[model samples]
Target chain A: MGRALSLAVIFFLVLLPLGVGGSTLFQLPVFSQELVQELLWQSWLQSAFVSFTFTVGLILAVCYLSLWLGQRITAGLSSSRIAPLLAVPHAALAVGLMVLLSPSGWLVRLVHSLFELFPSPPAHWWIADKSLVTMAVVLVIKEVPFLLLMIAAQRDQLPIQRWQTQAQSMGYSVRRCWWLVVVPALLPRLKFPLFAIAIYTLSVVDIALMVGPNTPPLIAPRVHEASLRFSDLASLEAWLGQWLMIVLGAMLFVVVAINQTVYRRFGLDAIGRPNGHSAQRICSGFGSQLLLWLCGLAVLALIVQSVAGTWFYPALWPQQWSLGRWINEWPYAWPLLQNSLWLAVVSAAIGVAGALLVLERQRSQRKKALAWLPLLLLLIPQLPIVLGWQRALGQDAGWLWLLWSHAAFTFPYAYLVLHGAYISFPSRWLYQAQSLGHSPFNAWLHVLLPQLRGSVALAFAVGVAVSIAQYLPTLWLAGVSYPTVTTETVSLAAGGDWRMASVYALLQALIPVVLLVWASRQGNQQRWKSKHVRN
Target chain B: MLEIKHLTISKQQHVFLSVESLQVAGGSVLTLMGPSGSGKSTLLKWLLGEPLPDFQIAGELWLNGKQRDQLPIHARKIGLLHQQGDLFPHLRVLDNLLFALPRKDPRRHQAALEALEAMQLSDKANAWPHQLSGGEQARVALMRALLAQPEALLLDEPFSSLDTALRGTVREWVFAQLKQRDISVMLVTHDKEDAPGTIISMKELTHA
Candidate 1:
C-alpha cells in the first residue's frame, strides 16, 4: 500500500507533468517564419544574455557571500538574516525594487533631499523599469538568498573548518585557503542548485513582466503573453516558446557543464599557482549586508508607499501618513487574502503529506534513487510544464485544479527540505520502538514523528512559502476565478497602482515570513521544553 | 528456553555465519563474541525480525516452547539494548519508561517510577535523556526495555559505550536485572569480559 502511494505521488507530481509537456511539444504546430525570426533574434537572444548574466552574477555573489559568512558568522545566524528575503516572492520583490530604484522612487527622493541634484524626479535613472539591466538586478537580488540557502544546507556535509585549518597550517592564507580548498568542494555540491537557479533565471515570468525589457520582452514573458490569448496563432507561438525555453535550458546546461570541466582542468590550477601578490578582495561582508539592507529598504519603501498620502517627488518622507488606503482596500482585499491563506495552507499541507509518503516509501526500501526524482520538478523550467497542464486540463479551472497546481510546485520544495533529514534518521530508533511492542505504524507515529517534528514543521513552512509565492500556476490554472495575493499583486503593479500593489505584495511576503518565524520558534521551543521537562 | 535451529545467514548467495542449533535456559546468558562485521549484530537484528534486504537467512526461533520465527518484532516479545541505549530524546527519562508500559494500565506511571527507583534514578526521572550521564542513561534504557516484559532479551554491545570505570558496574547491574526477571538472554560483544558464561566465537559458527 505504501509503495503504491509513493508511486502514485511520483506519477502525479513528477512524471505526469513531464509526460504532458513532452506530448504537447510533439503536437506543437510549426512556427510562422516571422514569429520564428522575431523570437530567435529579438527575445530569445536578449533572454539568453540576461539569464547568462544573471546566473553568473548570482553564482559569484552567492559564493563570495557564503564564504564570507562562513568565515565571520555562524550558518544559523546568516540563514535567519537571509530567510526573509527568500520569503519575499519574485513579483513582490520586483515591485519593491521598482519603488526603490525608479526615478521618483525612495532612492531618488533621498538623493534629491540631500544634494538637490534635480528640482524634481530625474528623467534618467540608472536602474529603470522595463529594461534588461533592472530585470537582471531584480533577478539577482531575489535569487541570491535561495542560492545561499542551498550552499548553507551543504555546509554541514563538508569538513570546511578542518580543511581550512589544514591548509592554513601548511602556510596558506585564510582567503587563499578558502579559494583553493573550500570552494572547489562546495561548487560541485552546488551543481543542482546552480542548474535550478539558471533555469529559473532563464524562464522567470512574473519578475520579467514587472521589470524586464518592454520593446521585445524576454522569451518567458512572451510565452506567458501568448499562452493567455485564445487565438490559434498565439497558442502556436506559446507552444514554440515553450520549445525555445527547453532549447535555451539545454544550452545553459551544456555551458555550465563545460564551465565546470574547464574550471576543474585549468581554473583550479590557475588559482593554486597564484602570483606572489594575492588578488584584491572582490567581495566584502559589508557589501553582502548592504544587499540584505537593500531588500529590507525595499520592503520599507513598500510599507511607506502603501500608506503614503500625497507623497510627491523630491520629498524624502511622505507628506502625510494615513491608514485610509488600507481601510478602503481591505473590503476588496479581504476575499483575496482569505483565498491566498486557505490555498497556501491547504496546498502546503498536501505537499508536506505527499513528501512524507514518498520519503516513507524510500525509507522502507532503503534506497535513495527516488530522492532526485522530486527535485527534477524544481530543476525543470516551470513555465512549459504549467502551460502544458493548462492545455491538457482545458479551461475548467476549479478549486481542485488550483490546489493541485499549487501543490505540484510546493511538493518539490517540501521534498527537498525533508529528504536529507528523513533519509539519515536512525533506523535503530524505530526498530527499538517496535521492539518495545508498538506496531510499525504506531512506532512511526509515536516515536519517529515526534523526533522529526522540527524538520516536518520546517518543510511545511517552506511549502507554505512556495505556495504563497506561486504566480504562474495560480494565474494560468485558475485565472481570475481565484485571485491570489500573487496574481493580484502582479496585475496591480503592472496596472500602475503602486499603493494597491504594495498592499497585496506586502501580504504575499508577510504570510511566508510569519510562517517561517512561527515554525522556527516552535522548533526552538520544543528543544527548550524537552530539556526542562517538569516532574 | 529461547532456542534457535538451523540458523544460517548469508549475503548474495555466500554463507557467512551458521548455527546448527543453540539454546539458552531462562535466567541464563548465551554470549556470542565476534569482531565487528562478523554477523554478531546481524544475528540479533534477524532475531528481532528486522528486514535485512541485502542478506538471506533461514532460521527457526523458539521462545518458551512457542515457534516465534513468524512473529513480527512487536509480537515477538523480545527486547533489544544497543551500545548507545538510544533513549528517545524527545521524551523525558520517566516518560521514556512510561512509553514502554501498556497505555491502558492505570498503574503504569507508578510502575515507571518504581523502576526508576530500582535503578537509583528516581530523582532524574523528569530530566531529558541528554542531561543524564552515560551510566544513568544505560540504566534507564535497560529499565525501559525490561519494563516491556519481554520473554527474551538481546544485548548488542550494550556496555561498550560506557567508560571502563562505569562498564563493570553497569554490566553487573544489567546481569542482575536479567537474572531477577529470569529472562533468556543472548549477548553479542567483542569483549569476552562482557560474557558471564560460555562464549561462542564467530569462527566456530562460520561454515564458509
Candidate 2:
C-alpha cells in the first residue's frame, strides 16, 4: 500500500505536464491547428505563474481557513460535533453551495422578494462565473468541517487537556487557554488534514468545474474535459500529465515553501502565546447559535430549493413545494441512492475488515506499516489515482468492479476511523481473555468486538460518507450512467441550473446527513452512559 | 506455583522491568511496591508475555513445575486486574463476570449469578459497570477475574482509581477473595501503604 501510494504521489506530481505533453503528442489535426503556434516563452511562463500563484494562494488560504475555523468550532463545542460535520460529503456540499451562491439561487431569490422586485428571478451567473471566488468559498466551507473532525480525533491524544489545565492554572483565562494552549496543540495534528484540503483544492475537478470559472477552467477541469470529451487516450493522458505536474508543484510548495514558512514564522509555541488576533472572539452567545443556525439554514435552503416547484423570481417562498423531482427522478435517483448506500456499506465494511487484518497482521511484527496510508489517501486528491486507475483499466467494466474500485477510496476512510481504536485498545484485556483460555479468534470476536463497537460504527459511517461523496471516481469508474446521488449532483451542477442542481445536491447531502445525525447521537449516548448502554 | 526467573521487560524502547527472579507458592500473595516509574507494572506484563520492546527477558518462568515462559498468555491460566478494575465497560456487571466463563456451559448464567451473589454484587447483575460506585466496580473487577478460575493472578495498580477510604476496603476484599479462591497472586503498586502480604520492594537496577 505504501509503495502504491508513493507511486501515486509521484504520478500525480508529473500529471499536468505529462497530460499536456501527451495531448500535444496525440493532437488530432483539428486540435493541433487550434493549439497555440506561438506557445512562446512569455505566454507559457505567464500561464504557469498564474497557475502556480493560484494553486499556492489557494493552498495557503485553505490551510489557514481550515485551521482557524476548526479551532473555533472545537473550542465552542465538544469536538464530537466534528464527527457528524465531517461525515457531510464534500462534493455534495460543494454542489449545494453552487445552488446557494448563484445569483438566481435561493439567496438572491430571497433577496429579490424582500425588495419586491417580483416578476422574474434575476438572470445572473454569479456561480459558475468566470471568477474563482465561489469555487474558493465552496472549498473552504466543505473542508473546515472535515479539518475540525480530524483535529477532534487527535485532541484526546496530544496532551490537550494537560496543556489547557496548565494554562488555566497559570495567569491565563479559559479563553486564553484555548487560544494559547489548545490551538497550538491542535495545529500539528491538523497539518495532515490541512495538507489534504490543500491538495484537494489544487486538484479538485468536480467541484471546481461545477461552480468554478469556466473560460480557462481550473487545470483539473481542463484535464477532465480533455479526457471525457475525446476518445483520444493520448490527448487525455497528456492533459493528465499537465494536471499532475501543476498539482505536484503546488503540493511541494504546500509542504516545503508554504508550510515551512508558516512554521518558521509563527511556530507552534509562538501560536499559543498572546497573538493579538487571539483576543478577538468572532462568535458569542446568540451570535454563535445564530451562526450554527445559519449554516443549518443554508443546508435547509439547499434542500428546499432542490424540491421547490415554481420557485422563481420575486417570491420569498416557493409557489409550490412538491415531491415532483423526487418522484419524477425516482427511477434515476432510487437506484443511485441504493447504489450509493450499498457501495458505502460494502466498501466501508471491506475497508474496515481489511484494516483489522492488516493491523493484526502487523501486530506480531513491529513495523509501523505506513499507518498514514489511510489518512494520506484521504488527503491526496482522488483525480490522480482514480484517473490513473480508470485509464489503466478501460472504462467498460462491470458494476461490481466499479463498486470495488470505489471501495479503494472508501477503505482508507474506514481504516482511519478504526485504526486509532485498534491501536489504543488495552493489551491487558486480550491477555486476560487469553489467560482465561479464550482462543485468539474467540478473544477478538467475544471480547474485542464489543469493546470496538463504537469505533466500528464510526468507521462504517466514515466509509459510507466517503463512498457517497465520491464524484470523479464514481463518474469515471462507473461511467456516470449508474447515476448515484453524487454522480447526479455533479452532473446537474455541471449543467449550471442552480434549482435542479440544488435539488440533486440536497439528495446527495440528505443520505449522509441522515446517517451522520444517527451516528453522532449514538456516539453521544455512548459517551454519556455506559459501555453496556452503548451495546 | 508461579515463578519468575530473570524476567526483563521494556516499553517504547525503555527498559522497564528487569526483575532477576521471584517465586510465589500456590495460594500465596506477593505484593510488589515501588515508586512511580519503577517498572512494577512492567513485571506484570512480562509474566503475561506482553512485555514492552525494551525488555530483554533472559530467564525462565515456571508455573506448576512447567516452564510457562514459552506458553501463550491464555494457556498460562493467569488473570489480571488494573486500577479501574478494568471491568468490561460495555457489559452489565453480571454479564462482565459471565464473560470469563466458557460460552458452551449450559449452566453459565446460573454460575455467573452465583458468583455475583458470592461477591454481594447480585443487585448489580443488570447494572452497568459505570453505574456502580468505585468500591462496587472494584469488587466486580476482582470477581470477574476470579470467574475465569485462573490458577494464578496478577494486578497492576488496581486500586489507584479508588479513593483512599475505598481503596483499603477494596484491597482487603481483593486479598480476601484471593485467599478464598486459593489463587496464587502477584500485585504491583506505586504506594507502599497499598502493598499486600509478603511485600517485595523493587530495587535499583545495575548492569552486573
Candidate 3:
C-alpha cells in the first residue's frame, strides 16, 4: 500500500507535468524569424539579465548574511525571525516593497519630512516603480530568508561549530573561518536550492508584473500576457517563450552545478587557505535583524496604505486615517479571503499527507535510489510545468484541478521540510517501544509521531505558505470563477489601485503568517512541556 | 530458561559464528565477551527478534522450554538495554514505567509509583529523562525493563557509558533487580569485569 501511494505521487506530481510539458514543446507553432529575433533580443535578454542579476545578488546576499548571522545569533532566534518572512506571499511582498521604494513612497517621504531634500516626489528616482533594479532588489529580499532556512537545515549534518572552533584555534577570525571553512562546505549542499532560486527568479511572473519593467517586460510576464490573450498566435508565442525558458533553466542549472564544483575544487584550496594575517572583523551583527525589520516595515507600509486617505507625496503620514476602505472592500474581499483560506488549508493538508506517505514508503525500502525525485518539482521552473498542466486540463478545467496544481507545488516543499527529520529519526525507538509490548503500529503512533510533531507542524505551515503564495496556478487554472487573494492582489496592484490592493495583499500575507505563528507556538509548547514537566 | 540451539550467523553464506547450544537458567546471566564487529551485538539483536537484513541466520530460540523463534519482537516477551539507557525522552520518568506495565491493570499508576519508590525515585516521577543523572537513568531503564515482565532480557554493554565508579554500582543494581525478578539474562560486553558469571569468549563461539 505504501509503495503504491509513493508510486502514485511520483507519477501524478512529477511525471505527469513533465510529460505534458514535453508534449507542449512539440506542438508550438512556427513564428517568423524577425519575431523570434525580436523576442530573443528584446524580451528574453532583458528577462535573463534581470534574472542573472537577481540570482547573483541573492546568492551573495544570502551567503554573507548566513555567515554573519550564524556567527552572531543563535539558530533559534534567527529562524524565529526569518521563518515568518517565508510566509509572506511573493506578490504581496512586491507590493509592500513598491510602497516603500516607489517615487512617492515611504523612503522619499521620510527624507522629505526630515531633510526636506525632496520638495515633491523625486521625478527621476533611483529605484523606479517599474525597473529591473527594483525587481531584482525585491527578489533578493524575498529569497534570502528561504536560502538561509535551507542552509540552517543542513547545518546540523555538518560539523560547523567544531570546524569553526578548529579554524579559530588556528588564529583565523570568525568571519575568515566562515568564509574559508564553512562557506566552502555549505556551497555544495546549497546547489539544488540555488538552482531552484535561479529558476524561480528567471520565471517569476507576478512579481515581474508588479514591479518589473514595462516596454518589453520580463519573459515570464510576456508569456503570461500572451497566454491570457486566448488567440492562436498568442498561444504559440506563449509556448515558444516557455520552450525558451526550459532551455534557459537547463543552462542555468549546469552553470550553477559547475560553479559549485569549481568553488569546491580550486576556490577552497587557493582562496580559502588561511593567510598569516588575521582578517579584520567587520561589525556585522545586524544582517538578519535588518531583514526582519524590512519585512516588518513592508507589512507596516501595507497597513498604513490600506487605511490612508489623501496620502500624497512628501507627506510622512496620511492627512487622515479611517477604516472606510476596510468597510467598503470587505464585501468584495470576503469571498476571495474564503477562497484563499480554504485552498491553502486543504492543499497544505494534502501536501503534508502526500509527503508522509512518500517518506514512509522510502523508509520501508532497502535502497532509497530516487530519494531526491520528488524535489524535482522544485528544480523545474514553475512556468513550464504549470503551463503544461494548463494545456492538459484545458482552459475550462474545474476547481479540483486548481487545488491539485496548488498541492503539486506545495508537496515538494513539504517533502523537503520533512525529509531530513524523517530520515534521521532513530528506528531503535520504535523497536524499544515494541520490546515493551506495544504492537508495531501502536509503537509508531505513540513514539515516532509524537517525537516528530514539531517537524510535521513546520512542514504543514510551509505547505500553507507555499499554497498561499501561488499566483500562476490559481490564476491560470481557475481564472475569474475562483479568484484568490494572491490573484486579486497582483491584478489590483498592476492596475494602480494601491489602496485596494494593499487590503487584499495584507489578507494574502496574513493567512500564512498566522498559520506559521500558530505552528511555531505549537512546536515551542511541545518542547517546553517535554523539558519542564512538573513533579 | 533461555536457550539457543544450532545457531549459525553468517554473512553472504560465510559462517562466522556458530553455537551448538547455549543456555541461561532463570535468575542468572550468561555473559559473552567480544571485541567490536565480532557479532556480539548482532547475536543480541537476533535474540530480541530484530530483523537483521544484512545477515543469514539459522537458529532456534527457546524460552522456558517453548520454541519462541517464530514470535515477533513484541510477542517474544524479551527486553533489551543499550549503553545509553535509551529511555523514551518524550515520556516522564513515571510515564516511562507506566508504559511498561500492563494496560488492563487498574492500579497501574500505583504500580508505577511503587516501582519509582523502590528505586528511591518517587520524588522524580514527573522529571524528564534528560533531567536525570546517568546513574538515575540507568536505574530507571533497568526498572522499566523489569517492570515489563519479560521472559528474558539482553544487555548490550548497558553499563559501558557510565564512569568507572558508577559502572560497578549500576551493574550490581541491575543484576540484583533482575535476580529479584528471577529473569533470565544474556549480557554481551567487552569489559571482563562487567561479567559476573559464566563468561564465553567470541573466539570460543565462532567456527573455524
Candidate 4:
C-alpha cells in the first residue's frame, strides 16, 4: 500500500506540470509565435525589476541573514519563536505590512506625533510608489520566518556539534565556523527553499494586490487581472506570463545548481573560509529583535483594526473601539469557520498521509531528484497552478475539486516537515524492533509509529495551516461557495474594509497559531507518559 | 547449537566478510574480533536476516538443527544487542521487556516482571531509557534480549559504550545470563577480555 501510494506520488510529481500545461494549452487558443514572443518580451521588460532582480536579492539576503540567525539561536528555540509568523498568510501579511509602512500608515503617524516630523508629501505616497525597496522590505519580512523554518529543518540534518568542536579547537571562532563550515554544508539543502522564496516573492498576486503599483502592477497581479477579464488575447498572454514565471523560477534553480556543480567539481564542496568575526554582531542582534517587535506590532495592528469602530490617519490609536465588527460578521463568519475547519482537517489527513508515503519511499531509495521533488512542487508558485486548474475544471468544480487542489498544494508543505522529522529519526529504532520477537509489521505498529506520532501530528498541523492559508486556489476552484478565512480576508481587504479584513485576518492567523501550538505540543511530547498518577 | 556454513557478504561488486564454518554449542559464546570496516556489524545484519541490497550473501544458518538461511529478521528468533543499548525510548523499563515476549504467551507480564526482577532493577519498571544510567540501560537491554526466548543471540560491541570500570561487570553478567538459558551466543567485540570460550577472528575468514 505504501509503495503504491509512493509510486503514485512520484508519477504525480513528475507528470503534473506537463499534464496541466498541456491541458491548459488545449483549453486556451494558441497564438502565433511572433505575437506571443513580442508580448512575452514586453512583459519581461516591464516585470524584470520586481519579479527577477529584486526577488533574487531579497531571497539571498534573507537566506544569509537567516543562516546567521540560526547559528546564534538553537533550532528548537527559533522554530517555536517564528512559528506564529509562519501562519500569517502572504496576502494577510502584506495587508499588515501596508498598515505599517504606507505613507499615512502607523510608522509615519507615530513619527508625526513624536518627533514633529512629516514627509513633504502625504504619508500614503509610497504605498503605490513602484519602489522595489518598499516591496522588498515587505517580502523580506514575510520570507524570513519561512527561511528560519527551513534553516531549522536543515540544522537537524547536519553534524554541527562535531563541526563546531573541530573548528573551535583549530582556533576559529564559533561564528566563523558557522559561516565557513556550516554555511557550505547547509547550501545544498537550502537550495530548494531559497527557490521557493524567490518564486513567491517574484510572483505573488494577492499580496501584490494589497501593495500594488496599480499603474503597472507586478507580472503576477497583471496576469491575474488580465486572465479574469477573459479575452482570447489576454488569456493567451496571461498563460504566456505564467509560463514566463515558471522560466524565471527555473533560472533560479539553474543558478543554484550551477553553483553547486562548479563548487563540487573543483573540490570546493567542503571548502573552508578564513576565520573572522563580522562588525555586524551588534547590528544582527538589533535587526533580529526589531524584526520580531515589528511583527508583534503588525499583529497588534490587525487586532486594533478588527475592533476599531472608526479611524483616520495620524492617530496612532483607533478613534473608537467596539466588538461591532466581530458581532456583525459573526453570522457569515460561523459558516466560514466551519468550512475552514473541515476543509483543513480532511485535507491535512490526506496530505500528511500521502507525504509520509512519499517520504518513506525516499528514505530507502538513494535518488536525490526524488527527494527534491516535493521541494520543486513547493517552489512552483500557486498562480500558475490555479490558472491551469481553472482551465481544466471550468465553472462547475465543487468540493472534491476544492479538496484536491488544496491537498495537492498542502501535501508538499507537509512533506517538507515530515521528511525532516523522519530523516532525523534514528534508524536503529526499526532495526532494534525487528531484532526483537516482533514481526516486521508489528515492529512498525508497536514501536516506530508510537515514536513518530508527534511528527505525524506536526505534519498534519502544517497541512491544516497550509490549507487554511489558501486564497487564490480556493477562490478559483470553489468560488465563494467555500469561504475560508483566507479568502474572506482577501475579499474584505479588496473592498478596502480594514476593519473587517482585520477581523478575518486575525481569525485566519489565529486558526493556524492554535493548530501550530497543538502540533508542537503533540510533536514534542515523549512517548512514555508521566509515571506519577493523580492520587 | 547454532551453525554457519560458508557465509559470504559483499557490497558493490566487492566482498567484505566471509566465514567458511563456525559453530556455537548451547551455553557457550564465540567472540569474533575484527577491526572497524571489517564487517563486524554486517555479520550481525546477515545473522538477523537483513543484509543490504548492495551486499551479496550466500550461506546456510542453522539454529538447533533447523536449516534457516532465508527468513525475515523477526522470524529468525535471533536476539541482537547493539553498542547503543537501543531500548524503546517510548516504552518503560518493564514494557520494553514485555514488548519482546510474544503476544499469545500466557505469562507475558509475569515473564517481563521476572526478567526485570532477575536484573535487580524492578524499582525501574516505569523508568524511561533516557532516565536510566548507562549500566542500567545495558543490563535492561541484556534482560530484554534474553526474555525474547531466542535460540541464539548476536551481540555487536554491546559493552563498548559502557564505562571501563562497569564494562567487565556487565560483560560477565551478560555471559552468565546467556549460559543460564543455554542460549548460543556470537559476541563481537575488539576487547580480548570479552572472549568467553572461543575467539573467531573475522579477518581470518574472508573471501570478499
Cα lDDT tens digits, model 4, A306-412, are 77766676677888989988898899888888888888989998998888777766665633332665655577766776777776676447999898888887887
lDDT of 1: 0.79
**Which scores greater on DockQ, model 2 or model 3?**
3
- Write candidate 3's Cα lDDT for A209-246 as tens digits: 88888865777888888878866567667767777777
CA lDDT of each candidate?
Answer: 0.79, 0.66, 0.80, 0.74
Best by TM-score: 3
Question: Order of candidates by DockQ, top first?
Answer: 3, 2, 1, 4
Task: Please name the candidate that would achieve the greatest DockQ relative to the true structure.
Answer: 3
Off by over 4 Å in 3: A1-75, A169-174, A269-284, A366-370, A525-535, B12-16, B102-104
Candidate number with the higher DockQ (3 or 4): 3
Task: State the TM-score of the second chain for every model.
Answer: 0.96, 0.88, 0.97, 0.94
Worst 10 residues of 4 chain A by lDDT: A526-535
Better of 1 and 3 by DockQ: 3
Candidate 3 CAPRI level: medium
Q: Which stretches of candidate 4 lie over 4 Å from their true place?
A: A1-38, A41-44, A118-134, A258-275, A278-282, A366-370, A526-535, B103-107, B206-208
Clashing pairs in 3: none
**Could you tell me the lDDT of residue A172 within candidate 2?**
74
Residues B1-208, candidate 1, lDDT per residue (tens digit)?
A: 9998999888999987798888889999989877788888888998999988999889899999999999899999999998889898888899999989999999999999999988888999889888998899899999999999999999988999899999999999999999999999999988888899778787775642
- State the DockQ, from 0 to 1, for candidate 1: 0.46
- Residue lDDT tens for model 2, A479-528: 64565878777777677666666666666677667766666665565555
lDDT, candidate 4, residue A302? 82
